[model samples]
Target: MEENNKIFDDEEEELYEHFSLDVDPGQTPMRLDKLLAIHLKKSSRNKIQNAIDSQSVRVNGQVVKSSYKPKPGDRIVVALPKPPREPTEILPENIPLNIVYEDEAVLIVNKDAQMVVHPGFANWDGTLVNALVYHFGQLPTSKNGAIRPGLVHRIDKGTSGLLVIAKTEYAMQHLARQFADHSTERTYYALIWGEPEQDKGTINAKLGRSQKDRRVTEVYEDGGYGREAITHYEVLKRMRYVSLVKCNLETGRTHQIRAHMKYIGHPLFGDATYGGDRILRGNMFSKYKQFVENCFQILPRQALHAKSLGFEHPEKKEWMQFDSELPEDMQTLLEKWEAYVQHV
Candidate 1:
């Protein structure tokens, strides 16, 4: 077995593995999928082929098809999404889903906060995948058939907002290409502690797992490590100590927005993992502390929401956009901030 180095991106909040391999100098040309199947022990040819069809396989830094024959000295890179949970008989559960749109090709859902997108670890049931399986019955799976039927992209468990699921194999391949190319449009709304110095700015940083804590993401200043992440933000409102901001992601790394905001010293309010749970801003007064605590109580999770998503239809080739209202908890928290600002 070839030695494989697996780097996990906790920010993406999913198990995606990136692999890089150099063809032997004397190796003969072979089909890319076959080469990957041989090199990737856990992956099957079907999975590698699906990744190629979705443009996730690259030769010499350019996306290639499975049919391409990799010559000796060629460098191959592939990215595969690993299902969070082990493959089991996923029985459909009658869970409530706020489905915004549905058709034979796709389904758009507005996931609620605190709900796991898929079953993983201790969360074995009552997930969005379980709900999808129950509602849609048998859905399309990736090549390996890991059981995340119909899911194309995912939002963090603490985030509430829109996601697109593909109903057919062709649709899945098409949607996957869009995400890999970074063509899909995604926007998020976040209530963060402390206002940014600028009204609108872009953060270009490299993100990798923190050496101190693997669960959290850290920004690299030298850009020598990790994946390149870009986030554009504009302040929507400022309530003295806290601010509401809109974030646009150029690259969908795990926890991109959360980590980037924290890197710039404006961690999202209530983001326990990134040190936003403590009072970062505001006065030392007991009343002020209590007010912040009350806000935290009202919004228990990270104050981030996937507010909008847009993409092209796989079959129709038409542009489609989805928008979701903030959940009651986030909205209520905003109201409290507004009220506090008015009173003060």
Candidate 2:
């Protein structure tokens, strides 16, 4: 027999879950972590071991190790703590969603611009997670019992594009493993400020958090501190000053495309975070400046979209892929640039 319950704090920062299990009379002795992993479908053996090391797991009111094995009739109690600052209570909102595809195991959503994918500090409400909770109700948790729900990957709040979410623990685990193994395919469309000298190229660099601004990521030339990131890009259309490009990602690091583009002096147009809002490549004429500003107004955020995503289905074991069209803002911005290039 097993009993489980969860408690949340007022600020939604910390979560505490208690699990009590009575050993079966016919059960053979097994490692505590392995047993806990079997009992908690959302938790992994490593997470169970961490709980045991944190003195959060006890057998018969005594702290135990990962190697501890339980006998029949033993009373086991486990206390699990979630990551700090993560919301404990995520309230569902009646926000509209552009659901592209959905099945019992997975869901593909065409996430709109200006939507936060998950709940975090300073962004607890009006997030995609809130809307998901409202529509779907009580999603499966992560390995550490955190309420990511069905999220397998995330796009930036300003970026619009396709996202695949897992609806079950098996799907979550399987998709997570695929992403970790770099087997999933992701492609993006970006409008960069300057035209690249080469039509197609690859930017291989290590990425890490910038010391100057902790909020953004930067490319590390020395490969000293950051993880490896690779982005392959090809010029789709050149408008003399700004060019539209397609980028394929080999590794999904934070700000990989934005940072890599900036490193090559071709940041995505209107990307205020990486010095792309200014007139980086156009002429000094006031008319050109006004045109650039107009384009900026049309497409305010970074002109990047997660255009496509491909992965293997967890349940069916079949390869699945999805694509999304560019949002209206991006389309209008591109049209303006094309007209300007043709007239000038």
lDDT agreement with native, every candidate: 0.86, 0.87
Predicted candidate 2 versus true structure: per-residue lDDT over 1-344, tens digit per residue:
65656563432344354677889888878898888888888976545665687677888878888898999889887755563578778888999999999999999999988999998867888988899889999677787756788887899988999999889889989999999999999999999988899999999998977756657999878654678999999999999999999999999998889999999999999889999988999688999888888888888899999999999999999999899999999999999999999999
Q: Can you list the residue pairs that collide in candidate 1?
A: 11-254, 11-255, 12-254
> Which sections of candidate 1 miss by over 4 Å?
1-85
Q: Model 2, which residues run further than 4 Å from truth? A: 1-84
Distance from true position, residue 72, model 2, in Å? Answer: 50
Cα deviation at 270, candidate 1, in Å, is: 0.3
Model 1, position 20, has a per-residue lDDT of 75
Indicate the residue-level lDDT of 300 in model 2: 87
- Which candidate number maximizes lDDT? 2
